[model samples]
Target chain A: MSGKSRRDFLKSTALIGAGVTGLTTTAKAGPQNILSEDRMGVLVDTTVCVGCRNCEWACKDAHNLPAGNLEDYEDRKVLDTKRRPGTDALTVVNEYSHGKNSSLPIDVKVQCMHCDHPACVSACIVGAFTKHENGTVTWDTDMCIGCRYCMAACPFQVPAFEYDKALNPMIMKCDFCFDRTKEGKLPACVEICPVEALTYGKRSDLIKIARDRIKRNPDKYVDHILGETEVGGTSWMYLASKDFAELEFPKLGKNPAPGVSESIQHGIFAYFVPPISLYALLGGIMWITKRRKELDEEVK
Target chain B: MKKFLALILVLVFTIGINAQQSPGKDHSKLNLSCKTCHSCDVPTKSDPCLVICPREKITTVYQKPEQTPELITINQLSDRYGPVYFSHKIHAQMSIMSGGCENCHHHNTSGPILKCNSCHETSRKREDVSIPDLKGAYHRQCMDCHREWSHETGCNSCHTLKKDLKDTKNESLQKKYSGKDHPVIIEPTKLVYETKSDKGKLVTFYHDDHTKKFGLNCTSCHKQESCTKCHDVNNTDKSKNQKVVTKKTFEDQHSNCISCHSKTENCSKCHGEKTLEPFDHGKKTGWALNKHHINLSCAKCHGSKLPYNKLDNKCLSCHKGWNAENFKHSITGLQLDEMHSELSCEDCHTDGNFGIKPSCDGCHDDYSFPKQKPGKLVK
Candidate 1:
């Protein structure tokens, strides 16, 4: 190869390496990963929810989705079939029959749990997902490559992919109304709930409130608080009359979801030792083969 | 000067002690246990260490339905909806058959009835979340019974949306409920029950006999009744043509009757082959009730005790105050003349047996009861 072309190629490679290192340094310094002590959270009291589905409509409207009239949500017949959050709708409320009283069904709103140690943030290949200090785990659409690694990693299976769209499909999930809350306004679902079953406040204060409710109404609610320690805790917690497993919540351990995979991946890539050693071994093999062939040619 | 200073200090100490001892309110007459309000053993005036809103332990202030406000406009938390026009008087009256004032005003103390907001904060994002916010409290109190009977959880049942207030219907509703009282409940005279008993299929209940003859209060048997017992909106149309028989446990079916009826009594007393007639005094006890006795409650003749005591057939048994002086002969439809006015009642009523006809054989042989004129036949 000519020396000039080789020099140009070497310059380009150095510039790319510098750019990658700069991006990694900035990501490490960003405040998005910090878990603030005063981060806000929401407490859902399932005992008080009336299965109105108003939260479902409010969530769609806030997210600029195709939400129909508010009166349409009053139709409880939709609750006959269970549903999960989709790309079109960011949240949904499902109904479960109360164990004691059949007339009063328990309604649970399903959405992104916004976990403290989010698997989506860890699994995103492009560094698109961010766990903000405000307890909101949001995804940036610009950096997404339609990998759908987040969908597989999520313990709650919250994030949905827009499979219908041929171009620029985005990952959708509840953003905890970060835009509205930034303006000192309440989340749409919490605002629209007629029963005030969803209470929003500091995460620390919310835990105290949830404990107080369970203490006050011992007979009305089960003692366990869902999402308190499940998957290393979540921004949204729940108080239910029956066990959360009965409400179709996935049973998970207290450890963070990405703990095992991240430990192995980070261990191999630490200080770039494994990749450097692999390249050195391959280079040594090629040199030995070339030297042997040269010696054979000389002997011939 | 030193002595005076010592005296002043003693007086100050005594006053301070007295202030600490009395909380200024008369808790002694409240009839409440100390632990109900106070978390600590010794609560002082400065630091009562009171439990937070001892709702179950507090004494509720009960006012008559008429004394309560007729209309209460709830606009404190109105945002998307207009103010709710609540008919407080009607609800208060309807509460009589259920749980009374304590049902809604569960946390009221022994004073003027406390408003719901006194304990329940108005803001949903308040610091203290031990109790529900005012909006939640109000909705829960209303929806508990309303949903039970009406099966409606729609907000439109109580609230009118701000955009839908263009018509005069809201005003008309406000006018309709203003100063309105719940209509008086009409009681049933008789109710017949078809029982599953093999001995007797028909069980007759004399409703009028219990209220008028036995003088049982409405609350005596209707304790803790749900509003759906009578005001079930879903069953209204169906119940009009057919009787709605609810399935109940055996204990529930006989609880009200067993409160008064003896457990050992024969089942045929209430249940028979056919519907039984109303109780007749003469047929049951052979003492036909007269005009005066018929109007009197059974409690007045027989003491207020259940399983009333029986009295012999003598006027003196009940009327111990009766005598010739106070007992006017004119009350018997016969006013004695001047000659017989001074005589004793025994002259006419032998052995105080006024149930029998008067005979003159005690006085003159020729003077029979009707043959001779006693008092010119006053009647």
Candidate 2:
């Protein structure tokens, strides 16, 4: 290659790199290609919940899923076990015994947190998961490879896969009653929560309302808010009477599960520097080998 | 002179002897006392100074606190033999109406009011004689009348009984101090709700004003009878049942509460007036909260906060029930408990509400977002 042409190429590459750096910097919290405007979400109030499993039942009904315990349903034996929402169930209410009359018993509802910076969204090779403008993590089933990467990526342990379906299988999780939310209605779980344990409203408004409730009844709830810091803040927020950890919510590291992996991948593959350096070193080795081969041939 | 000196020395010696023996005795008496006092020192003679005066003698009774016998309760006795708490106040109240404690008191023929131990000794020769040692005496006297007064022989017969013994000791002491003492507390008779009324017509109970606001004693309405007398559902007709079913009676009793409370009258109280539409419980007086709270089960959230509907449903209010740590997430895990699973989203996101948004910048001082690639702009 000509030296003038090579210099021009290097100059163009530097310009391209600078442009990429500027664009990437602007993308954080800025107007970008948001997948959809309507983001699905949920609101949980620890104070009002009875742990009756009515919302869990409603989710099952809406999804046409089977009951948790059909045999001893009337006896309510299933409640004896603490469970997360599985492939069959999208919502599960677990009972937390605060103490033996030392404190009040707290019941927590578990479901997909539907994070703003979804680990599942970043983990997907097929780009099935994407963030919507309204703060929902939506799935594009057409592009899903059923690799189960989304399952491992979710900080909430949501998204159960249909192992029973051999062909064209799908991942199941609370879609935040997306269909219902789009119609300007609260999710079925929110509608069915008898005690106003679950409320529905705009994400911004709901946060304010929850704050007001906590301010008014400071003695009734713990100070920590669940999901606010989880996976870069999930759209679904929760107020727990007990600490979030007591309810089994994970205390994630400063870097969200996906952010850590993304950083590692970026650090290695961000630019062509590492690979180009390796190629140069390999070419040098080959030249030495060629020199030795020529010297051996001349001696022969 | 010799005779006078000898007489004087003898007199001084006698006086010295008298002074040493009985310092406080009259000297005139001592002059007469040598022969008088020496006469007792002789065989078979009682000394006048050491004479036993029957009038100055005294006898004291030793009583145990348990056996002190002021108006002991069956519970006080029950602590010894599993509690069968009989209301002494109630028994005494009834006995007072029947003239006095004399109705139950077994008086000795000599006219001194016989002590309970006088009849009910440690052990009885026969059932008739077994009036009850101090324990049985109190229990029998109180329980016999209580049985006839209330007539329910269950645990409610006595063990559940309560009494005001505050003034019992003073009243008993006053009786001993003067004959003009009364054990009875005179109260003006007010119209009380009698669960055992002859008519099955649900008693018009003014429980809200009396019990809810005034904090009247539960026994005021329940009275001596079990709550079952009015509430028993199985016994629809008060007269015709072979055996009185107080449990069934309560079912009928609840109807009375429902009548005044309009919400309990129909399903619409909870399900909405227009069956097709939702119930606006939030707007109603009977309904303190909305369907969400009601569906979650009021008892669960307000389990311990019951009857008082103004309970705070804040996470901290209930979280203290689990553990108390100001501004820390240490109960179970990172997630909210099941009870708080349905809380509002804004609760955590905002700056004010104990929201979970800890500034990542607070800990990750060196953290930064990666820059964008060329042409991969957000806008």
Candidate 3:
């Protein structure tokens, strides 16, 4: 951000002492996460989705999240109430009205956006979260301290902390089916979408495709492409009939979310000047208070 | 002042020359206002500021089955299955019987049937979020019938399995649809149903009378019906015999006739003691639909919702708009001669109805229809 924030960031790494090298390396990486140019994306065409929750079932099954028979997902009653992605269900589809007084409803599937500049990785005090080169924002369960800072940082509110687990808990969210994609398979949700509403491809190629569609069918679509530039780009994109805000997507800026937090945190720790001054001030107060007590005891 | 005028003239000449440099596409000839294409008031090469896809003034389009495309290859989207070879002609012809060309080509503004990709995007990765993608479009259209008939959607039905992954189990589908005819829909003359009505158990439906005498189009009553209404078999599904669920509730069954006819007030019209005979125009209205009127649709004379008995028997009541130029006089059994044909029908026939017999008293004092021949008698 500014010279101040940059120094603060450097000072924090300096204060870490022995692990300073590793922390500094991660901070540089965190600010500018080097991802493959060919990192993939999933384009969710909400209009094509029929509210058949097959993708939801497939996601649960793939994640081993205790999903019932996939056929039961056919009952569209679940869509009557809008639901968000939780620990058990990695992905969920929510229904929004297509237009004013319109009978037809648009089904928008919600999950992790897998930001190019991930806020979770930035917010994690420990180096647990990773912005993988393949465009997946994943977290190491063993390293997770259950701080839930990622939950606060994520713009989409994707990551959920397992509050019920008394012994061991972990952050849960869509991993973009990282394991499956590594094996040359599609994400479970993308693979199972009956209408093929979710199209998986290179992010740049997907943007080109989306722009082409908008140009060809001007009457059918709004010009803007969601997730293309929102919060400095995300791997999971969306296409909807109405304004994305009406579809329950939060209004975001072109600037990445982590940039806001990183600037302040970095500024406060810049050059170790504030921390050193703060500690000295506290130490002086402690010394004065003890000296005052000693003088009172000597008088007694 | 003279130098300024000359500079202006030179500027105009340079602009004229620049305008002529671009040829062939004559935008000025279209007589459209510059604002139609140009977004800026003053357009230049660097900042032409052209508008894209201005959707106003949609013209209604019309097409017939024979005039539309015959076949199409849908291969834009890549998946495991091979692209479908769709029999566009066969489907078009079938639609002609059911709902005409608009059954599939629903949103034509003007010109020929629009390509599917015109409205539907070819790829799933698209910005047009209102209409479906090409794959979705094809499936949604096809599944209207496919889902209704079989209630199962296996990809191999429309798409052929890829050559490398081809199995013996996958049926040879590409060859089956060439020039395939959906068998002619048979119309029954009458159907007598036993209804739950306490006043009358039987309800006789004169199907032929409604179509022939009443002149109702098949589509007027069968709106929103699936092809599986009659073509109910699932021959494509390998499953031997799945129970076809072609159930219609009371409302669904009665919705067609009830739109115009009174289902609440006029129960006796349809409900009867036993099977009733076919509708007789002579018995019903005291005037038969004779040779001249028999082939005509009911709307031709009855004016869509106009009652059969309400029309005056006078030919002029319905033929008020017709004149000698439009009403072929030769079709009336006698070809009018050159001299007499010049006179309007009202001049010779004092009465509006031609059955009153024509008189030649105005022209020839002693002449009449049988006595004097004004026109050649073809019959």
DockQ of each: 0.21, 0.00, 0.06
RMSD of each: 10.0, 43.4, 14.2
List candidate 2 segments past 4 Å from native.
A1-40, A67-75, A100-104, A278-300, B1-379
> Which has the greatest TM-score?
1
Q: How far is candidate 2 from the true structure (C-alpha RMSD, Å)?
A: 43.4
Instruction: List runs of model 1 lying over 4 Å from the truth.
Output: A1-37, A96-103, A116-127, A147-149, A152-155, A229-232, A241-300, B1-61, B163-174, B189-208, B237-295, B305-317, B323-379
Local accuracy of candidate 3 as per-residue lDDT tens digits, B234-271: 43543232222324577766776787675665677776
lDDT of 1 by residue, B285-315 (tens): 9989877689889889888887778888788
lDDT tens readout by residue for model 3, A21-83: 777888787643346778889888776666667788899999999999765775667878989
Query: Which ten residues in a row are the worst by lDDT in model 3 chain B?
Result: B238-247
Sorted on TM-score, best first, the list reads 1, 3, 2
| Every candidate's chain B TM-score | 0.76, 0.22, 0.54
| Deviation in Å, model 3, residue A74 alpha carbon | 0.9
Q: In candidate 2, what are the lDDT values of residues A1-300, reduced to their tens digit?
A: 566797799899999999898889787638544433334345677755655566776777767787563212323345568897888889988877754221235668888887777889889998888666766667888898899999987877798898999999998888777776668665777765534566555555556667777787797778766766666677788997777887788887545668888998887776878778889999999999999999999999
TM-score of 3: 0.51
**Highest lDDT: which candidate?**
1
Candidate 2 accuracy as TM-score: 0.38
Question: Which one wins by lDDT: 1 or 3?
Answer: 1
